[model samples]
Target: MSPTVDHYRIVPELTVPGYASDALKAIVGATHAAVQANVDNLGAGTPSRAPRFVKLLRDKQIVDDKNQSIATTNHNETVSALRDIEASMDVNDEGVDSSTYGTYSVAGDAYVDIEKAVNQLQGTINDAENAPGPSVDAAGRQYWPEAVEGPLRTACATTAATVEQRMWDATTDIQRHAEHINNSAPDNPTSSGYGGTTAPLTTPWSGHSYVPPADAGTIDKIKGFAANELGVAETGTNHVNRPYNIDDAWCASFATWVWKQSGINVDWSNKNYVPSVWSDAAGKGWADSDMSSARPGDLVVFGGQHHIGVVVARNGNSITTIEGNSGDAVRQHTYNLAGGNFTGVIHPPAKTPVNA
Candidate 1:
């Protein structure tokens, strides 16, 4: 630490004497030690604790400055802030106030805690290097924390990163576990079915409709209209090599037919872009969206060489789409699993569309 850039120097008047120098020195020393410990954190096998790097920052404050009071102040401030943040992470103003209530708890402290954790890491690491030694704890486990000049820092860092990553992985794991449980149980169905039949979730379902499909066979009825009634072309595609079969990959045509049956208007003559009973009519784009106004029969078109489907139901990432050309079967399928040849979807025009 030769020719250290005096932080107090920048604040001219503070460089005068005792108070300024003392404060600056204390802060600088604490900061330096924190950095050192952080470096040690980069070690292969090093001693560590939770509030992980945060604890290191507080502990090192004392080690670097030998000022117990200062360290305590810094540490308590951090801890208090952390706790407040944690508490705040889930706030609800719905206390005796109807307008203030919400469907879910607010992000009371996550934003703050996450920010503090990040700032703590940056503040310490930016100023100093790692501290040293073979770290041992009561548990008798050893770690290679980054020492001021040893290979420890790398190890500690790798470990911290690993732990952080693991934490992230755990969150995903929880979500996946929940998904698995949901998938495993038949009682807690995945998607809300059209007529008491649940399917896997995929896209968003928002609008509430009192009218169920006039009939489950409504899906088939729509297709029949497109095939025998509407002048829809039975176009073939070299999409995957062979040609189009009425029984396979006829998703676009099937959807086109269904949209028309539900009283949703589609420009059947327009082959390049299928006239969605929804988008072309309702005006919802892929940009920023708000479907609070979307109705039941609106067409949700999946753009790509004219592929489309009908939105049977809408609830984010869990849409119920009725389609025809889905791998050789025309049935209701999930949006999430809509892969390969499956494109986007079309919300059909409601039962009241003029041209529908």
Candidate 2:
């Protein structure tokens, strides 16, 4: 153990000429060595211990140059402070903390311990960096609050941005996983009942008839609403209601509901009829056969408008969608762009003063 020099007083007036100087030098050297040893052990130890040690060292003023053998009063206080800190650190024969110091009680809880320790350190750093500084005037009106909160606020803002990006990535992963599980299940029971449709079809557009607006606010709302409806199963047998008061075959109604809720003035004349949606879009020059130009929020017509869904994503030859009344629930689907079932895509026009 490094020697405790608190009891070894050094007053230049009372001691021999050169003796006090030598004694103070020896104490300072030993204290410095003990501090270095503590730091080394902490760096090699568990994560939480090192930061706590650093914080305490600063708090106790043991790491200050002003405490190094100044006058009798300051020198004695420094020595005593060093003693207190060394004891707290459980310094041993090697001038290091106890072997078990700052260790997790259970190895399995190490991750939790490390996380808590990081949070504690972060809080301290934030507090130190954000509080009003000495430069602030007595009235506290000289500088902006942002200037005082700059470092901590910046740290939190950056962390918030990263967290948002990660959350989005996680949502995408969950969507893909749900799609995979739904795809692996048996064919949608309600999907096979589309053969009896008899609505007159509009002539399929040969090329792009209308380009969607540049802003994506409405499209984002459409996709958001559809995503929120995932797993909303039909309440009872053929009793699905996509706000159409319908009992069955509500795929078109579901698509219409999503569009209407997203602030698009969709035709509700034949809201439950799949082909009615296609014909309206066709007549309004909103229909297109180009799968490559398809986008989220577009109504995707399947089997020549025999069935319909709201497009949520498109990648190469793969299109992902959400359709209601599929297996008696709102379910996600991913189909090939060149698949036989995919007939066309529709870009609905937004109502005036579109929802922002």
Candidate 3:
């Protein structure tokens, strides 16, 4: 008896385009295996071999047909979707309508929240764009742009120049004043030390200048008294009354008279001896033996304390003096330290004594 062959038919179903070719290949392989098994059993003499071969061939053809149908459907679906997108994108200057793309209206609360976020973002951008101008740090230093810094620098430079100019003006004024003091002369004939013109003979001297002390008023008073007596001789009626006659040595008397007129009290009052002035200064601790330590208005004792004069100015080794009895009248004289005529200097108190 012949064995019965059960023939199973494969029906093609609609599959996704991606898996259609793989499914078709699997169906063809199964048909080929079934035909191979039937032929191996039937051999060349069996009539069933041709029928089984035809059936396998028919199954492979059906799977190929199904694969083609699936490919065509997928292509059509893609074309339809693309055409719908193109139609929706069709615009004519009138902006995209909500109808063609799909209506999308934000909820009221969500719209308000998004608007607030956008405003905050805009505020941040504005702050970044419009920043503050130049400022100063806590350390009192200025940090500024070149535009502001330029004017400040110029102002500082201008102020500095002005200050320098003022300093130069002050210096010139001081020099002129020194010259005036150096050139001044006594007006009266009896005031000449040697009974001649009381004007200074040498050119105005220059050297380190010093600040006049508070009692400089006393010096001014002494100078004024000496100037008032200029050109008057000891024999003249304007001379101060002394214990001795007008012809005797009046230098010491004249110095004491000037001091008296200036309201200054000294031990050598109404006395003609010059050494007494040095003694008084020594007793009072107002004497300076060093000539270089002498300042204007100091009493200059000369000829080993034989003569005394008021110092007008000091320039290096030279000193200008206003003296009485120099050539028999009040006069201005310039003396050199090298001459060894200057013995000592007597310093007057800066303030007059209240009692004396």
Candidate 4:
């Protein structure tokens, strides 16, 4: 026999009143787990539990007294029981009441996420800098599609060398906990201390002549390669699905496949580009530039850095751009607005920056 829990207030959700305390932990765990799990698996732009869970918890006196809704306050005992639980939550960034848990402030949550993103970016830059080149051609020009510059200077990579060193030095001026995340740390022990940076100075092939594989045959072949090799996220639904809709966005995966083919190298961790986020600078976006200025074969970025397309022909407002995840296969679209998802364009190198 055990002492019965006397209810000062009613809990409609939990029939067994004595066991409600144990269930409280599980609900909190479920809510928190949803957030952490999204960060661990999805990486960006994921939603968690909706408002109903919070309301139910509030009504049951499972949250803290301060956080309980005015409705929950109708019962005096419910309000009193939640007081301790809310106190416990005070230690964490998020505060909880007897019946409900509060989320972190927008700025507070963003800080930690930015930190993880920087970690990922650093590892990527390191790998790209160290990745081996394809081979040196007869002209003696160094040819490594994926090579990145290291923090320290080395022989094979000059442009990457400059970029790494610049990114390294740029961190000195950054302020606040979140702004510091933009600058990935340096290997130099001095840089690890507060107020340090090594920023990107020069891009790959900035001054060198980087030659892309010239004899890829034809533009149509590239289209075939893009369509056949890459998954275009298809327009229509499967056997049983919704109609072809704007809700479908296949821009990132298309860009990833094209970048691989062109060899304008960068490190891709998951191999597939994440579509849910417009940030991360990973998708097919470009900067604002005139149609006439963009050359043939230049990769046009769009959508604040989301979708990308390859230029084929241009005539003032009308331009033909090859895209993988639009209309049908890798086909051409014409428009002055650049399909509305416009951001910027990145021109692939015909010759190394040093040589050109």
Clash numbers, per candidate = 58, 0, 20, 47
Query: What CA root-mean-square deviation does each model show from the true structure?
Result: 19.4, 24.4, 51.7, 28.4
Task: Give the per-residue lDDT of model 4 (tens digit) for 266-307.
Answer: 343322333222233323333335534665445565543334
Residues 185-241, model 2: lDDT tens digits: 333334334322121212321222223345757777788777666666666875743
Local distance difference test values of all predictions, in order: 0.33, 0.50, 0.44, 0.34
Task: Say which prediction, candidate 2 or candidate 4, comes out ahead on TM-score.
Answer: 2
TM-score of each: 0.25, 0.38, 0.36, 0.30
Cα lDDT tens digits, model 3, 1-356, are 01232222111211112212332323223323332232222221111212232222223232132122112234344344333322222221022111112111212222233234334433432342245433556885534443432332232223223322333343354345434532352223232332223464243222222333456576676666655555443455325333323454566667776776667767552266565466556646778888888766677776435567777667898776677766555667666655645668887765763221
- Candidate that beats the other on TM-score, 1 or 2, i.e. the better one: 2
Ranking by TM-score: 2, 3, 4, 1
Model 1 agreement with the true structure over 272-292: per-residue lDDT tens digits = 233322233333232112334
In lDDT terms, how accurate is model 2? 0.50
lDDT order of candidates, top first? 2, 3, 4, 1
Model 4 TM-score, all chains together? 0.30
